[model samples]
Target chain A: MPGEDIVLRTEALQKSFGSLEVARSVSIELPRGARHALIGPNGAGKTTLINLITGQIRPDSGKIFLEGRDVTQMDVAGRVRHGVTRTFQINELFPNLTPLEAVTLAVCEREDLAGQFWRPLTAQKAAIDEAFDILTQLQLADVATRPTRTLSYGQKRLMEIALALATRPKVLLLDEPAAGVPKDESAMLFSVIAALPADMSVLFIEHDMSLVFKFSSQIVVLVGGGVLLQAEPDVVRRDPRVREVYLGQAGYV
Target chain B: MTTVSQAATDPHSWLRGQSRWSYFEIAFWVIALLPFYFFPTYLTLASQIAITALFAISVDLVLGYAGIITLGHAMFFGLGAYAAGLITKAGWGEPLTGLVFAGAFAALIGFLTSFIIVRVRHLALIMITLGLGFLTLELANAMSWLTGGADGLRGVDVWPIFGWFEFDLWGYTAYSYSLIVLFLGVVAARRIVHSAFGLSLRGVRENLTRMPAIGSPYRFHLQKIYTISAALAGVAGALLTQTTETVSLETLSFQRSADIVVMLILGGTGRLYGGIIGAIIFMVARDQLSGMNPQYWYFWIGLLLMAVILVMPNGILGGLSRLAGRRS
Candidate 1:
């Protein structure tokens, strides 16, 4: 199933923090339009893999290829511009900006309008429209004009995804899309995320196996910083090793 | 400066409010212009306040809006002073051109140094900027032949507005010219901070790491704002040189840089008008205190600053806005 349509590929990624090996020869591939879920127990280096793929942290050894081009040497912004983007588990959003303004900022950034000082924001009608559309899609259109800080926890978390979507990323890495979200809102959040464009590859880190089993086309179970199994939802659910990894963990129901 | 409805019908309407004039803003500018006609004797002091306010605004752009904590912004101000003074001393004394040239000169230096400046953050950034300020001061002092050394760059001659009005002793022309420039600077600064670029700057300041995920490189935005801030500061410095006919080593002094930071904090940060209000409050307090006790004026100024800060931690303007918000 490893096709030429892979949008993101980590070739034998290895990282270590002193004596602690967080990622040991971790390799993963995300094909175009793939709905891949990265499921693992706590301290499984799920976030570390996302960080390496998004250029937030350097791997001790490996090559990160975006659309088959090596991007390991690139910076975070450079990689993002080349169609790699990620959302934080903690909801890293601009508290000072409205959802519309924040999303417009991302769209302007995507279109490279961030440098245009002469034109006012009103002049970027197309970008603003696109930003509003992204907000609408996220069901954040009702509160689009309110300050981001005033939004509910669920809404703010969705705003994070809105920002990622505004970048129009080819390879979207969601580091636990519903980290702090309540159980009821988590399903709704995943629904919005699951409705993202088919042409965009999505790799999400989710502890909620229900969402993972429900929304993910494939699941990659990570254990001890290494890929234990990469297969369909049923295969991952039936794997005994995967069961052992999450035995004591709250994630395995 | 902008307000949008929670349920706006049109997407473009969100930006429409930014262009509309606020009554309070108009009244503020009008009151700023009133001092020229009402209190002519204080015009010289008023002009100096305008220049200082512009300088403080420049600092605000870099530190407040861009989230760059700099302790040595006087480097650009001093560079502008010397550039304007030297250009006039070279026999071309066009006031408007001097302002533009001085701003450009400072911007050039800012852009050149931004490579090193934009790469650092927090305490390291503060030290590097302070180091840069000191380097400029020593360089200017060392080049006494060009800058007139400790004696100050003297004989800075500025021609009248369109060759009609001279920079008189009463400071009629200086007050008019400085106010106009300050007004334009405020307008331009307001426009920049409210634009898409400015919005992104706020985003960068809010979360430097988050910008990359959205595809806006933080370093380049910082570089652009830093350069723009330097240009405004240079223009302010050039205004001082042109109006006073002198450029001193103190322009680049650490005290000058430190003072603007105080004024910004005393007034507010992030907001554009904070700097101007801070300059006025500080300059007025200094003037009144110095007159009462010339030798121990610092004590009084320090006391007054502490009182203001203790009461209004967000600076005078920020506190006032919060009060107004509560009342409304």
Candidate 2:
């Protein structure tokens, strides 16, 4: 059983592809409601780790725990139903559906109404209201009726977040949420992230140091397929090893 | 603030302003009623179009909405035909009962087969579906005593629908029965496509990778839709068998499967009415063109299909909808 205080915990997670070790005995713990940032240089297995946690790929020999329950054996959908959800590094919104339709699906799924077929989706007034409420919170109400494909890059990124948030997830995993957005729009995106409910735990992998420094309460640095250092944001910022491994390469003092 | 309040009260406002009845749908119903008045002698042809449209709609559910390309959907249709035919031959000839039995049997087969079919994707899915069709065809052919061999199951006698309306020579009963079934099927399919479950199936089609992340088990939803499609296809088969009073090997042929796919593509995909419009256009064209020259009818059909494809790559209805500035 996972401890009550820790919402998500990985124990000695390891993965390898042929001769390459992408993750080696990596262990991390996320406390309840913690805002954590995972930062690493390129090729440091950040994506691979996110994949393992979300059950996209299995870890060779390790355990994953969610809310004190072992979920290492759970599939992606099972993990999601258990209140874990994630956004793609690249946008994965349904191009044919409007943002309202897409987010409504997420909301309906969370409400256990995804199997309903006999009634019109519009009849789910409460789900629609909840979905609209989420869109409003994400500042996407104006464009909710437009097809997702027509949205600008930054809007799509936020739409992806809206999709994730609509699941009512206890732990949200964001994989490079601001990867392709313009720098100017990314600030708006981060501000929205900063405004998420306080009880929701978040683990995000990002390349932007400014957003990382401003948003994360705690920072975990990954290097060479293993955890290099995990500490409070300020300590991680000032760590010599962290500076040598990441800040040095990215020209951040 | 008023917009939000109006949206809350008018529940349908959330559907992106799409209405249930479009001019096209209204026109379709009007056209469906035409055979009863103008050409009573051509009721058989109208009934055939209705049944074929039902089959095409089944294909659309999987191919258009769920994105599972199949080349052997006729297996379910044929199974349903055989089941209904056998039931009538056994002296229990209630039309509705036979339809239910046939549909359920076909759904059972679909449920069993989907375990393997849902595991593969792309070319492998097509091959497996095609193989299943052939396998069932061979089984039917081998069971000569039961299936009547290549000559086909014969002497199927259907009881009058509800013991009131008799199957008649002028094809009035067949046409009305088929039209009613087609109407019910269309309503059900439309309801499904507009539901949350339907949306998830589209989600699976749009991105298999992201469906599970959003709490939809990919294989489960595929299996569910596949089974439902098979059941509906079975209903179409049952309708055909009951109307014609015969079940033939042609019903199981790969060509039948391919024709339905072509009809679906000809109409449009992903849209509920695409298959219905496609079947009407394809069958009507085939009927008229084939009457002109039975020997080279395929040549004319081929030319017409080529023209349709070249002019509207998305499909006939898809193109028309675009021209009308309607959101698909």
Candidate 3:
């Protein structure tokens, strides 16, 4: 994998909020097809890093590179077009609109058909087809016609991922994709996320250790606004620091 | 799961399912046509209703679809009124071109102000819109040479509709002209709301922040909708000037902006027909009530507003849906 191109990279990103440093010289990389986890405690600034990566907020000093191209100055929409996108921990969806309508809009956005106003939505058959395909992939096709608000919490979570897929991002960021979902649906949700197109690298944040270790091939543990460790799951599991500070396993290992 | 792929291959049927013409929609339009036959004497009021309905629809686009409420929407309306009046006074007397000029002029101003509007939200947005409205009113009053000031634009001479059918004292030509324009505006608006762009406009209203994640610029969408709404509102104003043969300061007043909002709330927003229905009821109520008891008309209107709000929090269409046991 040495010659493989990295899909996403961050260079010594520095950010602080008043007296507290949220991101301190934090740097990480995801190679093509990487499924990486971002794990941290309550104040580890995991969400902050996600916000910075997705260009929702700017960092004080740092650079973000997507597919070897610098994208630090890019806005959220610019970053999304450049193949980097994210799903929220809290569902951000069009409550009154059906999933089919929402997903079709997402496809239209990618194809620049959003300005097609003279014709009806039915005329965008190709975009709708593509949207349904994305919905089917996320197992959201069954509830596609229902208003997004009426969907089960699990289905709603999947809908978020379905929308992210419509962007066709090269790197997908998941901020607790399984947060608040029922246990049974949570596992299914993770599986669907885990099985996203192989070429699209995933960077996810999770507080659920079991889900993290079970799904993420690699883990980046953030502590005190910095990367404490970035390694394979086994290495992270065996590390005394992670075991003590996060796992809280004083004697098991 | 089997149904999933089938829908993936066929979205046309799914789209058709949502847009099937209801009996109510057809009947509504058919009823709108009846004023031509039955309301011969009240054609003046009918024409006014049509013009105000068009204005309400324009405001509906911003508040209902884009979720950007404004207290200064009358600025566009007034500006359009003035444009048509000024153009007619300047010898362009062609009605259709006057309408187009008015719309474009207001749209230009709308586009410029949208940059300021879309950048803020909630209370701040409302204040900015109110400020814009006041500024427009003062501008109209200060520039009395062109606008005719508080006395109104005196020499707005509108040409015959379609180079035929001159406006008359009985209000036949004016009613027909305004109604036709309003109908065309409705058709155009319905097409827009059912388009991919229109759905995205709803998306902007529902979740502004989420749009960027899908590579859609939220601010750009808001600005576009605002400009469009402004343009339509301007056309409605042009209709007023063309029909009445004058432009008044009241066209740009704070009251005009507030009244449209009230009308939309009464009819329901988002649904394209809400503004139309609301305008009819509000205008008709004003006429009938003022004729009977001019000074207390406001009291009755206030009462009606309270009752409507209390009984139907979502307005007429929304309340109707609820009564039918359907979630709108």
Candidate 4:
């Protein structure tokens, strides 16, 4: 496929921590609206790649393009304004704000209306309405008024997604969206992902192969801090290198 | 009960429910008209209450809503007082003009200090502010020719409000004027604390990481609050200088800063009006105890403060609100 339509591209990204190299000249193109799964074993630099793209940490040398815009030097908030948002592997919702309030805050931030502190919250009806709609879409309408501290692990993870969605981002970076989800909830989460808008892209890091195989349009296998291969799921399943690195670890021939 | 529900439905519910406004309004009318009947001793207590209350509310801008704890608030208070006193005694301006200049001077000090202050957190920030206060106080004392050093400024002629209400030597005009300014200051402060900016400030206080991630420049918001807070403290100090017609080196002392903190905590931090109630209670207690026995009074005051601190951790007003909430 032509890379011109790509929303996010990392060009030979490199990062190292003292003697340990986390990412070394890694490159990839995530096309617009592509449901791309980044599958890797532990210490395979999945999170490091996510951080580099999101500007949490600077790469030693690389160019990051988000929607035809270079965002390599943008600070965290600057990156957010550029439409790059990520949910933590560990859920990072505001502990004290209600789910609706947290999502409304995100929506407000995206609109650049956060500085207006004189207006009452109830006056921001349009923002609140949009936030509630996102919460309902994520099956969190019942818990919208509940403080995130009281939500179940599954709900908290879902709220994190809802929080990210409120930003109206074009590219959503979900770091292990199913990390702590129960089996039933995992299926529900996959279905929810399967039902998202065709124009919005999802790039997620996942360890669960079954869920990855079921939902991903394309799989990018990462092994030892670099792209091992990028291909269709069936091609990935047949590749010996992928088998040796991942399936071998789980002792499945 | 009816008014409570009405308050909930009102768009201005935040203003209506604020104890700071309610208690301040009540105290304003009572104290403003007190000179008509009360003894001169009572009026003196009222003037002290006005000054102390102004300081506490100014500190509340940072402490209660912005979640910053300052131990050197007296720096702004003392600076404002000294600046006003020096200006008036040197024949620069009238009472109101002196107060405004005092505010501007304090605002400059606050703006410069906030660059270093906003970067630190908690205990370290407190220590830095404390050191700043002490440094200013020493500087004022060392400049004895202008400030009167160990003594204080005499011959400070503040005149009167509007050039007609000449302040009676017994302070009739001074007490009424101070009470009026105190009332307006409290109302203005109430508006700010309940504003949308105030809500965001609370959000920042709740989580700094989340605030910036949602598109706020955390440092800018913090610095703005700090500067505004200091200016308000300056106004309070200038008001005191106007009332007493004197500025002493003690305005910048660490004890005065500590006293402001004690007033805020005693009324209950974060409970808007707690500052005013705390100030009134503290000043009244101090006045009564000191009048009864000048030597043994401080010991009794300390015991009383300890009792209030231990018994009502949320302070008098906070405890009362909680009780009211429970009953409902």
DockQ of 3: 0.65
Over the stretch B260-285, how does candidate 2's per-residue lDDT look in tens digits?
Answer: 99989988998868888888888888
Candidate 4 lDDT by residue in tens digits, B106-224: 99999999999888998998999899998999998899998998899877888667777876767677777777778777767766665445656766777776664555566777887
Q: Alpha-carbon error at A70 in model 3, in Å?
A: 1.1
lDDT for A11 (candidate 3): 99
- What digit string (tens of lDDT, one per residue) describes model 1 on residues B68-167? 9999999999999999999999999988999999999999999999999988999999999999999999999999999999999988887887888899
- Point out where model 1 deviates above 4 Å: A1-4, A249-253, B1-7
Instruction: Provide per-model DockQ scores.
Output: 0.73, 0.54, 0.65, 0.30
TM-score of each: 0.96, 0.95, 0.96, 0.85
Tens digits of per-residue lDDT for model 3, A5-55: 888999999999997899989999998888899997777889999999999
lDDT of 2 by residue, A112-220 (tens): 7877878788788888888888888988887777778998888899998999998889999999999988898888888898899988999999898988999998888
The docking quality of candidate 2, as DockQ, is: 0.54
Give me the overall lDDT of model 2: 0.88
Off by over 4 Å in 4: A1-3, A117-125, A132-154, A186-197, A247-253, B1-40, B168-172, B289-328
Candidate 2, residue B305: Cα displacement in angstroms equals 1.7
Where does the lowest 10-residue lDDT sum fall in candidate 1 chain A? A244-253
lDDT of every predicted structure (CA atoms): 0.90, 0.88, 0.89, 0.79
Candidate 2 segments whose C-alpha is farther than 4 A from its true place: A1-4, A247-253, B1-12, B16-19, B326-328
For candidate 2, the TM-score is 0.95
Candidate 3 on B98-170: residue-level lDDT in tens? 9999999999999999999999999999999999999999999999987899999997888887788899998
